[model samples]
Target: MEEKLIELVADVLEAEPGALSLDTEFKTDEFDWDSMKGYAILVTLEDEFGASITVDDFIAAKRVGDLLGLVSE
Candidate 1:
């Protein structure tokens, strides 16, 4: 799930798969993470994992690991 999530995020953010880690912070200048990208990620996650991610949940996820937890939950 971690690897898949990383790849999903990378794809959504147009980043290299090797660039993301669980601890990596989102919305940083390192990645082209903006509101649109965030929404895309959330929608993708919901589609991929069958999890309902709220906007508040996405905003609360400060890092990749947090997103992992949300989906896993």
Candidate 2:
């Protein structure tokens, strides 16, 4: 499950499949992550994992693993 979440984050971030680690920060401006990408990630996660995540979840998520934890729960 964590692997899938990592894959999703990598895909959305346009990074290497293995580049996203559990402790990867999602809010770094250096990564160029924006609201549109964040929304896309939320939609993709819900569609792929059948989890009802909201924008608030994205806002609350500080790292890739944080979102994964929410899905796991």
Candidate 3:
């Protein structure tokens, strides 16, 4: 799941596949993860994991690990 998460995030952000890690912070220029991208991420997560994510969930997430937690839940 982590591998898939990494791949999806990297693809969405147009980042190198090997560049991001679990501890990678989303609130940075390196990730280029603005709110619009964040919404895209939520959409991807719902489609990928068949899970519903809320705006609160998106707002509370500060890192890739938090996204993992969201999907896992």
- Across residues 6-36, which tens digit of lDDT does each residue of candidate 3 receive? 8888788888878888888866888765878
Better of 2 and 3 by lDDT: 3
* lDDT tens digits by residue: candidate 1, 1-73: 9999999998998889898899989788788567889889999999999998888888989888899988988
All candidates in order of TM-score, best leading: 1, 3, 2
Best by lDDT: 1
TM-score of each: 0.94, 0.89, 0.91
| Ranked candidates, highest lDDT first | 1, 3, 2
Query: How good is model 3 by TM-score?
Result: 0.91
lDDT of each: 0.89, 0.83, 0.85
TM-score of 2: 0.89
Question: Which 10 consecutive positions of candidate 1 have the poorest summed lDDT?
Answer: 26-35
- Candidate 2 ranges with C-alpha deviation above 4 Å: none
**Candidate 3 positional error at 23, Å:** 0.4
Tell me how far the alpha carbon of residue 34 in candidate 3 is from the true structure, in angstroms, after superposition.
1.8
lDDT of 1: 0.89
lDDT accuracy of residue 38 in candidate 3: 82
Colliding residue pairs in candidate 3 = none
Model 1: lDDT of residue 55: 81
